[model samples]
Target: MKLFQDKVAIVTGGASGIGAAIVRDLADEGATVIIADFDEDGAIRLADELGRDRAAPFGVDVSDPQAVEATVAFAVAQFGGLHLAVNNAGIGAPATKLADIAIDDWHRVLGVDLHSVFYGLKYEIPAIIASGGGAIVNMASILGAVGWAGSAAYVTAKHALLGMTKTAALDYADQNIRINAVGPGFVTTPALEKTMTDDERSGLAALHALGRLARPEEVAALTSFLLSDRASFMTGTYYPVDGGYLAR
Candidate 1:
């Protein structure tokens, strides 16, 4: 049998990039997935490509508690139960120094990157418990461990996300639910490709010991493993698929 056969999963921000890759991997392994994202059309396209029976599209603003709750409920109502989840929704703040960061930008970054994860945990946990138990992966970043200039909001949110992941994992460990965070370094996603010049990309890649940005599939592989029985004994841990970026 496939790793996630008979499992049901939800991947927020799943229409593209790393989240989309995770959705594909899970669905390919036999899980029914809900592609939740602010990009409704993109979600629909991905879901259609995966086949309607294997995946469904959910339009949601993860920052909204109501929308997040509805997403968890949708998984159960649509697929019968919830078994896995990836809170992959996030946004970057503008390149502003701490003193120059706008209030709205700070709140916006926190709302999507940090608060959304909290909302996911709050709703996903109860559903998972009701379904007997499962696993969850929160998509964090290298910023969670280290700081970056002019990225104070994003950095702060990521650091807090790691703490939340650890605490939630501990809280639900005895209940057979596994919770973990994934910290990825400079992934080559569609958005990055569109905005970054070759030189800019090269500069970021040089920061990693691997001398290359990570592929979305690389991150997806780790996420799928964590959500599967292969990682049965793991919980409350932060796994960094950072291409040795933090090694230095």
Candidate 2:
């Protein structure tokens, strides 16, 4: 049987980039996935491509507690139970220094990148417990461990996520629910492509020991493994898929 056969999963921000890759990986491994994202059309397109029965679309602002709760309920109501989830929704803050970042920008980054995951845990945990327990993976970043200039808000949120992952994992370990966080280095995605020039991208790539930006699929592979039985003993830890970026 496939790794995730008979499992049901929800992946926020699942319509594009790393989230979309994760959605594809889970569905391909036999999980019924809910592609939850702010982009309803993109979610729908992806769900359709995956086949309606294998994947469904959910339009949500993950930062909203109500929307996140509804997503978990929707997964259970539609798929019969919840088995896995990836809190992959996040946003990048502008390139501004700590003191220069607008108040709105700071809150906005935290709302989506940090609060969203908290909301996911609040709703997903109960459902997973009711459904007999499963695994969850939160998408963090290398900034969680290190700092980056002009990214104070993003960095703070990711740092908090690592702590949250550890605490939540410990809280549910005895219940058969595993929780973990993934920290990825610079990944080549549509957003990155649109935002950076080739020279800029090359400069960022040089920061990694691998000397290149990682592909979304590379991150997805680690996420998939974490959500599968293959990682049965893993929990309450942060796994870095950072291409040796932190080796520096």
Candidate 3:
């Protein structure tokens, strides 16, 4: 599992859920990983648990370009250079129709879900380029490929993220940097639990052809692959780890 040995990686939103899972997978596979998240305590705890030598905590508001740049600098300062990045920090929009959604809510959701990714690439691309090239994975959603009612902002951000990933991949293809996006179906993370009742969760699960929700680790595995050399030929693509949610 030393696929990422000697590599340096950063995972935004690395404190919990799919982000945390990606951090653990990358660390376990011998990469020095930085847990970049606004949840400072959780990030620190995870880094400590993974052993301080192999992991470090970086608290950052990804929507802020300055904070994102600092996070990239921190990774380089701590691990020598950056080779991989998972722009996974994002938030859900209020479940409301576009006509009813608040203006502030729209801005907030887009800030975290879409703007943050741009900030990440703005800084990370240069750092990775300085390191002589690397890979990046943006966390998107099945909603990126399909419409989800009552989630205008979230759906819009994911769709736009997929477009960004493709465009960036084309821009960096000859520069040794590979970029891609991952779209996951309903995953039972702490965040999701806070938003849905048990019955609602069950109903959502039934929509997936697998008759169950995806696990955080499952999506983590796909993301790890995208960031590894094994996926060397894979770029500018959107992969769905959705338990067949999009099949229907």
lDDT of 3: 0.95
lDDT of 1 by residue, 1-248 (tens): 99999999999999999999999999999999999999999999999999998999999999999999999999998789998999999988658999998888889999999999999999999999999999999999999999999999999999999999999999999999999999999999999888889999999999999999999999999999999999999999999999999999
How do the residues 163-234 of candidate 2 rate in per-residue lDDT, one tens digit apiece? 999999999999999999999999999999999999999999999999999999999999999999999999
lDDT (Cα, tens digit) per residue for candidate 3, span 26-113:
9999999999999999999999999998899999999889999999999898778999999999899667989999999999999999
lDDT of each: 0.95, 0.96, 0.95
Which regions of candidate 2 deviate over 4 angstroms?
A: none
TM-score of candidate 2 against the unseen true structure? 0.99
Evaluate model 3: give its TM-score: 0.98
The deviation in Å at residue 80 for candidate 2 is 0.9
